[model samples]
Target: MPAGIRLFLGYAIAILVLIGLSLRFVIDQAISMPVSPLGVVVMALLAYTIFTTTLVLQRKEAARGLAIGLASLTIPGVPLAWFTFAAGPLGIVLAGLTALLAVALLRGLTGQRTREWLSEP
Candidate 1:
């Protein structure tokens, strides 16, 4: 019911789905990857760990925690989203727009902290 729980569940569900898909494509298939299948699984697990950690942090730290969690997930994701262009227009636009939204949301969430961090003495 609460947004934080909903977000945690969303992250958990997404990670599980990613592992399932990776099992189908990476583990089951003979195709090669830039990273090993085990490596891919490990990274996904690592990311999931961060998300779960952030979920706890959110309860304690509020916007700062949510910003960190979302950043860890989406910042790297944005660049990788470009690969979607090869899949066609929908993939390109969807990824592009989602990345934009993520960036804007991150900026909105951390604007003052970011400005302060960047300020010189």
Candidate 2:
């Protein structure tokens, strides 16, 4: 596998871990009242991410687009990280790191090596 794919897989795994950690909050909200629509949407997106990651691992040509789409989704989070930065200096550091990671992921996914590797049989 190419470095780009490896990076994306790592990112996907990290996202899955975060989703797992947040499941308790999502479930608690649901148990106390009506299901949170945001939770539902997040779950759906998680499923899609998992599916796309699997396809990429299999080296399916279509996965290039799917993976690119997934990487693109992270772009919005860069600015959103600023909301967390309001908490403290730690938040500021975290926000900067997250923004950097998002930008790197986008570049890695769209890099020429990644495109060539994914396009191969």
What Cα-based lDDT does every candidate model obtain?
0.55, 0.82
Per-residue lDDT of 1-121 in model 1, one digit per residue for the tens?
Answer: 2343444445556656766666655544435656776767656675755665454444443434444464456656666676756567766776786687566645544556443432332
lDDT of 2 by residue, 1-121 (tens): 7778898999889888989988888888888777689688879988988999988988778888888788877767756776757776776776787778878887888888888877745
Best by TM-score: 2
Overall local distance difference test of candidate 1: 0.55
Q: How far is candidate 1 from the true structure (C-alpha RMSD, Å)?
A: 7.5
Residue 76 lDDT in model 1?
68
Worst 10 residues of 1 by lDDT: 112-121
Estimated TM-score for each candidate: 0.46, 0.84
